[model samples]
Target: RDLNEYLFEPSKLVAKVTDIYLNFAEYDQFCSAVSNDGMSYNEQLFPQAIEVLERIRHPRERIDAFLKLGEHIKTIADQHKEDDVIYNDAPEEYIDQISSILMNDPVMLPSSRTILDRSTVIRLLLDNQIDPYTRDPLHMQ
Candidate 1:
């Protein structure tokens, strides 16, 4: 029973990660449609997310597939950016506090009330649970 419970937790986590990945893809599609340009998720931080996913050890095939797809997407997006400028006209207010880049998916921290890119926050939280600005416990909902 203990072993079963332990295994079950990772499966649940995998499901959640998959959902987040799909949502990001949908959002990227929306951005592409509206901008008629190559704006997509921050390619710089994508590798970090993939590294996290690679650590998950059932569903090996599913995880591998995701990694493959993510790599392909990143490659294509990189090519597009090289051909044209992306988000060069973004306002200063739309920048992420941490990354200092144009925010693709901005999220507000409840404690510090600081706005940062979703990718930046996720990367920080993966290393530490505390909010970077306030140093308070961050509860992701």
Candidate 2:
């Protein structure tokens, strides 16, 4: 479980496997897996593991944990948007029509039809707080 937590990116499959192994290990390692504090640990890993466990916990717990995981991942990604460009690994055909706001890279915004890259969005927001297409007030701030 510890190795999986360190190696794999947080996902439902990885999270579930880690949860199983940690419970199977049944020792300090299990404590380590669930503990919230550890400088070397990925903060997202524990919550992801807990959410995976919650799927079998109870009905309401099952629903909210997964939803919370999605929201958590999105929030973290949004926070990093300025510092990192989210790459689109889809085949060229899929993104060919999408123009990144930065170097016209092929990446589209998930929430809208906006296809601009991160840098372009920053520049545009600096000048005008409106979405390019709808002219709607950019609520990203």
Candidate 3:
């Protein structure tokens, strides 16, 4: 089924998006409580979500309200990061090889089978299309 069908209704669409945003916010809070990694999956997706919302012909008030909520979530995330303590007790396998930090969201490189933090891999791929460890052509699935 095409998601566009369900998202055509502004009220339903807003509700779904808000639910997803809340879930991301909760996950970020959980991560912040455990580690001071300075990474947020919500932050990564906010711009994309905003761009999509801008293209939709939704009520201005709804968009504004969503933006306001997003800002509040970001503020809370920032505060959590500020007060978070560095976690140094992660097992070696749980650490990102590239960043040398605890991996909150880890992914394995298909070619090399090496595990690294999702954010680190994304940053690396932005600079080059090859895997850092194997220098092989990489595609993030």
Candidate 4:
């Protein structure tokens, strides 16, 4: 049957579609694609997908349920360096952004004092064998 057949079903298909869109691997791609480009990337596909996800009863349940996805999204955004460029190159007001969703968000990793990516930090610090205060920022003085 075509989509028209289900259009009048009145079933909770909309909710289910929302659930998948909200909590799925594709979400990362969606976020990155949108962040890197815009709604024009896939035309109305992104917006339409978001609409379906929002129709769910508890959308956050799906979005927040998977912390890894958020982590990936944050990391992807960070790795893209868009925020960093704005924070550094652009005016202060031009690139202000919070990597962590909340002030208490687990750093940016699955573990460690930093939270977000403790291993990445540990590896970098260890490679340089420098103390926190004497790292690159201090010019390794």
Q: Whose lDDT is greatest here? A: 3
Instruction: Give the alpha-carbon lDDT of every model.
Output: 0.66, 0.50, 0.67, 0.44
Model 1 lowest lDDT segment of ten: 30-39
TM-score, cand. 2 vs. native? 0.24
- Estimate, for each residue in 1-141, the C-alpha lDDT of model 4 and write its tens digit: 576766753225645644554555566567675445533433334444445555554456563543344455556756666654644544333221323222222233222223323333444446764334334321111
Give one clash count per candidate, in the order shown. 0, 3, 0, 6
From the highest lDDT down, the ranking of the candidates is: 3, 1, 2, 4
lDDT of 1 by residue, 55-129 (tens): 654266656666655666666666556644666577788988777767879999999999988978888888888
| 1 versus 3: better TM-score goes to | 1
TM-score of 3: 0.42
- What lDDT is obtained when candidate 2 is compared to the true structure? 0.50
In model 1, how many backbone clashes occur? 0
Q: Give every collision pair in model 4.
A: 107-116, 108-115, 108-116, 109-115, 109-116, 109-117
Best-first order by TM-score: 1, 3, 4, 2
The weakest ten consecutive residues by lDDT in model 3 span 31-40
lDDT of 4 at 17: 49
